[model samples]
Target: MDPFHTYTALSHQELGDRLFQGELIIFSIADELAPFLNRTKQLINKHFGIPDPQKAHLALDEPTYAARASETMTAFERDPEIKSLFFSALETCGVNREENFYDRLVLRIVPCVTSYDKGRQASVKHHRDTWGSNIDSQINWWLPIFPLRKARSIALYPDYWNKKVANTTSDWSFSRYLAEKKATPSGEKIAYPSSPQALESIDEQACFTPELQPGEILTFASAHLHGSKFNLTDKFRFSVEIRTVNIHDVKHGKGAPNVDNAGNVPMYQWFKQIKDDKKLVL
Candidate 1:
């Protein structure tokens, strides 16, 4: 029942082998379930904080979404177990990051609604996660803040990088715009592909569908092509998308200036309390 031990036992690399080169790796943590579930309830306490399925209300800011991101980041970071869970999970996956104790090494939290109560489930279109330059190779640890059914899950294409998506000068080049039209009709729109040939090359790569229960963790490469599916159940799908990168590789691209101003963003955030935090204790 020791979460850390079980997490350590799970061969993330083997999970990788089962995956296509660029496929996302999905797994869950056994040790941190109690605390994680508690945190989810806290986020939904109507008397104390914000409620879900509702937009920023008269009492809340119009951009309550951004505020929620900050709140979720702070809540998860405060829990030491979640911190250990992330680092251990990352190491299990063969990713190496630079060490800077107090920098925000972790990135923003992405919350998506796949299904709502009785309404059509919100779905994200097909697209790569992030494309800002200077953005070092990053990955996402997707954990459902609450339990999720297999049917109301995310869909991802394996080896997306091998697909040859183009970004040429033609007016018809494959940019985020076309991707929005083709993939995510409501979510983010992509610009031009960073590499024209890379898209087609990685096409037809196999992918896997994963439904993450509470405390389950799914990690995948930054460049992997992935997207979420509709949440068909009546209950809300509360999940967090935690993005991270190697601290040593922080200075990689045009994302540098923004990264600099962001004050090391997610990394600085990680080292701040990872050591003393007990949430990591299985």
Candidate 2:
């Protein structure tokens, strides 16, 4: 059965059990999330110099829009309050913010055009995050800064949970991509990212697209094959995502199955202890 299982709350760490089983969990809007959204929207709007971020593309050209979006996203990541609000929301949803380790807060503003897909566009393609990081014990938490529709939301390919799909994980490197990026001129768009990508077509796969509202949390295993939905709505979509790893899960090697991943890098170093911002040194 291709029947999908989605829950409304995450009250504890038993989440590892459900997530590794390929279940998707959705947490309702919480008091902590509201403040984060407010602050995020404020920063986004400020960076783009627009009152409504949905129409940000209309106000500026594609290149300008991308620069502004990058500025906003970078600013959001550097802001102290945004990080605090992020961890606070996690705590409200049963995550022990003080006990686990977390990666960086990734702010994504997706426009309708592909030319603007500069840095963080790889995840919008079909592939499990573990295909790149090689760490399956991480939990991916997504928050839509704006309301989502069919065209602007994300799609998870549940049918391929245990199936093998050809991918480019065996031939991708972030360091090489950066070196080539430096060789390119400043204003020109560099070559496409060499991140993990699906080599086979998944056009006929059974997919699940959940329409989420603002201030909601979409939590799932990092190994779930997911991608951005079609952009027929023509409106820009903004969202935030962060990954956390339970120290216990790490020590025990607990996570989803590695169906076809070819990556070998242990991405544990990017994570920092929640209790004390100490890096998870190898």
Candidate 3:
């Protein structure tokens, strides 16, 4: 089967089967999420005192932009209202959030005003999410905070579904990386290692989608090869992503093994038992 598949609509069961089969699923939830995303943008602009958060990236240096973005994200994540709205949105989309295990969701704010700016480095290079602490069975969910055109959206390399790429995971230490990231000053983003990897040479065949609106989501397994495409547009690209794993799948060994060694420890230190809210050690 092809690795990428787009759906106009899907039931909860269909979404689960497709995800477990390692296929990419794109579907809509726009009506349910637009208002929440709008509020989030307003909060960011208010926090930065900028009329347009997208253009603000052009005026500030990389570190300053990262700091301000981080501050806004921190405030947004800590807000109880935002969390409630997000979970509600997920439930409305047929996701049983109560039955899944997920760490905190993340907001990604990319401010790139030009093609020549170093801010392009902020865009992710081709890699699998499993290279992080994510388990192989984890399903990643992403949605743009604003409407995203094809040129500005992320691209996936479907041909590499079962192929290997030269990466620096052999020399990387997940535990050390986590500790260093924690030690870094607040409001700063940590830079990953810049060693050359095979992904740098495989861009010609990547697949980019049509414009993805605020209410839609794109999901794929941890092993999917994906990365950011250069933002040719003048505005900043903002998005949110979260990863979830079904404990039953994990316990039954129903998904791929963690051969990539993405991290020394599982991302969530403890998985919340849906029935009783007990902490299950990973």
Candidate 4:
């Protein structure tokens, strides 16, 4: 995508509306730019020393665990075009940077093989990106490095902000679990929130799972619940995820921490009971 051209193409009002109503929006640069995107991916792989792209998997086994790559701020600083695209995605999103936008960006590449194996379920469980975060001004941008075919997709609750379950409880634990959908069925092996009550409040009609192609971007609020589905395709799945936080919103800001490490909590453990038993289907 021509960073400048696309940024100008997307109307500011359209961008604002996207952020206001839906928790997420998917976009892509023109396909004609595929060769450029591919070269960037190749460079990233060379810098990281990952195996050939053709051999990557999507399963979550020991091999999958070994497949991890990240680029620091310096990487962006090194390339002007990369920086333009990075900033353009934000500008196109109508981010109010002048209001002291303290957005942080991250780039992540997940090899396809990580999801290829039987035990490679990437259902990391639903959770808000804002939980325990002092700064509530954050959003996620997921851009797949390659095209996603059938079975490789992302699922999201379309109008999650409209759900009665949102902020229903002042109790941090109950509220967070409900918001994250990490709560399991009550009295079951898993300590999920009472499914009958929770499900009753959610709009079953608003759920959606959209498959993303290379260069496509999915942006959403930190409170939105989202996750990756098991890879059903033989091709490798790679993507660059960027997160932005409004710095002025920080109040004794703890800063964003690792999502994988949040499992130590009791509520997280309760959800895991369902996960361990493979009973969490919702």
Name the top TM-score candidate: 2
Candidate 2 clashes between residue pairs 3 or more apart in a chain or in different chains: none
How do the residues 1-282 of candidate 2 rate in per-residue lDDT, one tens digit apiece? 534444545655578888888888888855668999999989988898977778766678776776777688789989988888878877877777555898888898777666655554322678788887788888888879888896788888888989899998888887787787888654455575545889998954587877888867888898888887756676788888888888778788899999998888877887998767898764
The TM-score of predicted model 1 comes to: 0.49
Q: Candidate 1, residues 1-282: lDDT per residue as tens digits?
A: 111112323343353333324444555455645454564456445322655533323234424544454455456556565555556544544544332122233322223332121111234445554332223344456666656675456556653455533422232232454464565432232333322222233332354556567666776654555565544454445565665544344433312112111112232223222333222110
lDDT of 1: 0.43
Query: Over the stretch 58-160, how does candidate 3's per-residue lDDT look in tens digits?
Result: 5776667666776887888788677667766776656675557765577776555543233212567777777764566677788888778777887787667
Indicate the worst ten consecutive residues by lDDT in candidate 2.
114-123
Give the root-mean-square deviation of each candidate in angstroms.
Answer: 10.8, 2.4, 3.7, 12.3
Off by over 4 Å in 2: 1-12, 114-123, 181-194
Question: What is the total number of backbone clashes in candidate 1?
Answer: 45
Clashes of each: 45, 0, 1, 21
lDDT (Cα, 0-100) at 86 in candidate 4: 53
